[model samples]
Target chain A: MARRRGERVTRWLVGGPPGAFLLLFFLLPSLIMIVASFRYPGEFGGLAPLFPAGPGEEGGLTTENYRVFFSDWIYFQIFLKSFGVAAFTTLVCLLMAYPIALLIARSPHQRRDLMVLLVVLPFASNFLVRVYAWMIILGPFDLLFTRSAVILGLVYVHLPFMVLPLYTNLEKHDPVLLDAAQDLGATGWSRFWRVTFPLSLPGIFSGSALVFIPVLGVFAIPEILGGIHDWLVGNMIKEAFLGVRDWPFGSMLSLMLTVCVLAVAGAAAWLAARGLQRA
Target chain B: MRRAALAIEALAIGLLFWSFFSDARYALAGAALAALGAAAALGAFGQRRELPHFWLWFASILVYAFLYLPLAIVVIFSFNDSKLAAEWVGFTTSWYAKLLADVDMLAAARNSVLIALTASAVATVLGTMAGIAMHRYKPRLLPFMVLTPVAMPEILLGVSLLIFFLNTARPALALFGIEFDLGVLTVIIAHITFCIGFVAIIVRARLAGMDESIFEAARDLGATPWETFRRVTLPLIMPGVIAGALMAFTLSIDDFVITFFTSGVGTKTLPLEIYTMIKVAVTPEVNAVSTLLMLLTLGMIVVAGRVAPDVLRGK
Candidate 1:
C-alpha cells in the first residue's frame, strides 16, 4: 500500500510540470482566444467583455463578427484563396518531392546521407531568409506579385516538409515487393501504382497535413511575394487585428481558421490511422 | 566508361564557366547544367556494371552549385565596390567594415542572441522534463497536450498571446504602477512557448529509443527515483537534450512571424532588420547579412547532425 502511494505520487510529480505548462500556455491561450472572439473590440483594439455594454456592441449578444466574415465577398475570397493556395502547394510539393524522395530512398547509404543534408540545410535557415531569397530570384523577373510566385514560394518552403516524411516511409519500404512485381512482369507505372504508392500513403498524408496547415497561416510569403490581389486569410487576420484594430472580426476569422485546420488535421489523422492499419 | 565520364565532367565545367561569363543569367546556366546532369544520369544508368566516376563527380558538383549559387551570389555581391547595386566594378571589404560599425545592427544582434539564449534554455528545460514524463508515465493526457501546440498555427498563437498580454495584463500591471513594453520579453515568451513543442518532440524521440529497463534496474538496485533518473536516464538522453537545445536556439533566432506580432517598435532581430532593409531597398549589405546568417545556421545544423545524426535521420 505504501509502495503504491509512493508510485502514484512520483507519477504525478513527473507528469505535472509539462502537462500544466502546456495547459496553461498553449491550451489556455487558445481557449482565451476562442472566448475573446465572441466579445467586442474596445477602443484601444483589445477585447472587451461580452456583457452588458461595450464599444463594439449592437445590443448585447450578437453574431456580427461571424456575419461580417460570412457575408463579405472579399473575406470569403481570401478564405477560398488561402485554402486553394495551401491545397495547390501541397499537391505541388507531393509531386516534386515524390521523385526526389524516391531517388534518395533508393540511393546508397552515404549518398542518402548527403541528400538528406541537402534537403534539411535550407530548412534550418530562417524561413524569412528563404522567402527573401525567392523574392530576389522572382522579383527581378517580374515574377513577384503574382499568384504563381506565391505558389512557388509555398512549394519551395514546404517541399522539404513533404519530402522528409515520405522519405522516412519510403526508406523503410521493402524493395523486394517492387522487385517481385517486376519479376511478375508488371510494368514500372503499374508496379508503383499497385505497390509503392499504396505503401507510402501514410507518409504522403502526414506530409500533406504538415504542409497544408502551415501554408494556410503563412503571412510572410504572401505578403512579400504575392500581389495586393493575392492576399490570403492570414493577411486579412493581420490587417484586421493589427492594421484596422478590429479584434472582434480578427478573432472571428482566427477561430474559423483554427476550426478549419482542426477539421483537416482530424481527417488526415484518421486517414493516416487507416493507412497504418492497412500497412 | 572513362570517355563518358570525361565527357560529363567537360560538360559540367563548360556550363559552370558559361554561368560566370554569361552575364549572370541563371535560367540559361540552370538549363545547361540540368541537361548535362540528365545526360550523365542516363549514362550512369545505362552502364550498370562500371559506373562513370566523373559523371558521379559531375552530378555532385551540379548539386552543390544548385544549392549554393544563391548564397554565393549574396556573399560575392557584398564585396562589390560600386554602390550602384548589382553592378560589380571591383571588390572591397567595406561592406563587412560597415556591417561591423553599424550600432543598430549590433544592438539587434545582441537582442537576438539574448532572446534566443533565454528561450532556448527555458524551452530545453521544460521540454526535457516533459519528454521524460511522457516517456516514463504514459499519462492519458500527454498525447493531447503535446499535440496541441504542435498543431496550433503561429499566427493564431501570436495574435492570441498579443490579446492576452495587452488586454489582461496591461491594465492589471498598470494598477500596480508597473510599466512594461511588449518587446524582448514578449518575443522571448512567444519563442519559448512554441519552442517547447519542438524540443519536446526531439527529446521524446530520444527518450522513446531508450531502454526503460535500465531505469528499472537502477531502481531495483536500491537507487532512488531521482538517482535513477540522474544516473541512468539523464546521461542516456543528454544527446537529445543538447540537440533540442541547439534546435531551439536556431529556431528562436530564425523566428519572424511570432516576433513580428509580439515585438515592440525598437526590438528588431536580424531577420526583422533584413526584412525592413529588403522592403526599403535591396543592398549588398543585406546580402552580406544573409550570407553570414546562412553560414551560422549551416554551422549549427552541421554540429547538430554530428551530435545526433540518428535524430536527424528521422529514426
Candidate 2:
C-alpha cells in the first residue's frame, strides 16, 4: 500500500506541472479562441462582454462572424488562393528535394551524415533573412512584389522540411528492390517510375504535409514579397486582428483555417493509412 | 565514371555561382552562364547512360546551389561598400559597425537572449519531466498535449494566445487588483509553451533508445524512483536534456510569428526587431545582423549536434 502510494505520487509529481501548464496555456487558449469566434466584436476593439446583453442591447453572442465569412465570396476566394499557393509550394519543394534527398539517402555511410547536415544548413538561418535574401536577388529584376516572388519565398523557406522527412523515408528502402528491377532489364526511368516512385509515396505525402499546412497560415512572405493583390487568408487574418482590430472576425478566420488544416491532416493520414493497407 | 561526374558537377556549381555576382553587373554574362548551365544540365540528363547516375549528382549540385546562393548573397552584401545591394563595388565592415551602434537593435538582442535563457531553462525542466513521464508511465492526454503544439500551425497558436492573453489577464488580474497585458513576460510564456513540445520530443527520443533494465535495475536496488532517476537516469539522459535545452534556446530566439502576435508593442525580440527594420527599408545593416544571427544559431546548434548526434538526425 505504501509503495503503491509512492508510485502514484511520483506519477502525479512527474506529470502534473506540464499537464497543468499546457492545459492552461495551450488548450485553454484554443478554447478561448473558439469562443471568441462566436462572440461579437466590441464597440471599440476585441470581443464584447461574454454575457448576452439586456435583451434590447447589442448581442454578446453571435453567429455573425461565421455568417460574415460565408456571405462574402472574398473569404472563399482567399482560402482558395491560399490552398493554390500551398499546393504550388509543396509541388516545387518535392521537385527540388526529391533528387537531393534521394542522393543523400543513397550515399555511402560516412558521407551521408555530412550531406544530411549540409542539406539542413541553409535552413538554420533566420526565416526573415531567408525571405529578405530573395528581395535583393529579385529587386533588380522588378520581381520583389510579384506573385512569383511570394511563391518562390514560400518554397525556399519550406524546402528543408520536405528534404528531411523524404530523406528519412527514402533511406529505409531496400537496395535489393532497385537492384532486382535493374537486373530484370528495366530502364532507369521505368525502374524509378514503376518501383521507386510508388515506394516514395509515403515520403511525398509527409513532405507535402510539412510544406503545405504552414503555407496556409503564412503572413510574412506575402506581406513582404507580394503586391497588394497577393493577399492570402493569412494577410486578411493579420489585417483583421492587427490593422482593422476586428478580433471576432480574426477569430472566425483562424477557426476556419484551423478546421481546414485539420481536415487536410485527417485526409492525409487516412490516405496514408489506406496506402499502407493496400501495400 | 567518377571523373566525368566530378567534372560536370563542378561545371554546374561554377555556372550557378557565376550568375550570383555577374547578374547585376553584366546581365549578358549572367544570361550566357545560365544558358550554358541549362544546356550542360540537359545534356547530362539526356545522356544518363554514359555517366551512370551522373544527372542525379548534377541535379543535386544545382539544388545545393539554389539552396545556398541566396544566403551567400546576404552574407556577401553585408560587407558590400554600397548603399544598395545591387552591385558589390567593394568590401567594407561599415554595416556591422552601424549595426553595433544601433541602440534598438542591441536592446532587442538583449531581450532575445534573456527570453531564450529563461524560457529554455524553464522549458527544459518541464519538458524533461514530460518526456520521462510519457516514456515511463505512458499517460493518456499528456502525449497529445505535449505533441500537438509542435504539429499545429504557428500562427494558430499565436492568434489563440493573443486572444487568451487579452481576455484572461485584464479580468483575472482585476479580481486581485493587478493589471496585466501582453509584453515580454507574455512572450516568454508563449515561447515556453511552444518550446516544451520540441524539448519533449528530443528527450523522449533519447529515452526511447535506452534499455528499460537500467531504470528497472535502479528501482530494484531498494531505491526510490526519484533516487534511481538521479543516480542512473539523469546521468544517462543528461546529454539529451542539454541538447533539448540548446535547441529550445535557438528556437525561442529565432521565433518571429508567435512573438510578433504576443509581443504587443513594447517587447522587441531580435526577429521582431529585424521585421520592423526590414519593413521600413532595405539596408545592409539588416544583412550584418542577419549574418551574425546566423553564426550564433549555427554555433549553438553545431555544439548541440556534437553533444548528441541524434539531435541532428531528428531521431
Highest-scoring model, lDDT: 2
Roughly what TM-score does model 2 have, to 2 decimal places?
A: 0.96
Cα error, residue B252 of model 1, in Å, equals: 0.5
- lDDT tens string, model 1, B1-315? 645754665676567644643466686668777767666665656654564233344444544444455545566677778664534578898888888898988898899999999999988998888777777777777667775666767898888878767766666689999886688998998888888878888888888877778888998899988898788888898889999999899989988888888896878999888878777777667767777788899899889888888767765
- Candidate number of the best TM-score: 2
TM-score of each: 0.91, 0.96
Off by over 4 Å in 1: A49-61, B1-67, B84-87
- State each model's CA lDDT, in order: 0.78, 0.87
Q: Which tens-of-lDDT digit does each residue in A1-279 have in candidate 2?
A: 999999899999998999999999999999999989998888888888888567766557789889988999989999999999999999999999999998988888888888888888888888999999999988877788999999999999999989998898889889999999999999889988988887887778888888899999999999999997679988988898998889989999999998999888887778767755654
For every model in order, what is the iRMS? 3.1, 0.9
Model 1: per-residue Cα lDDT over A89-161, one tens digit each: 9998887777778778878888888787787777776776677776666554568788898898788777788
TM-score per candidate for chain A alone = 0.92, 0.97
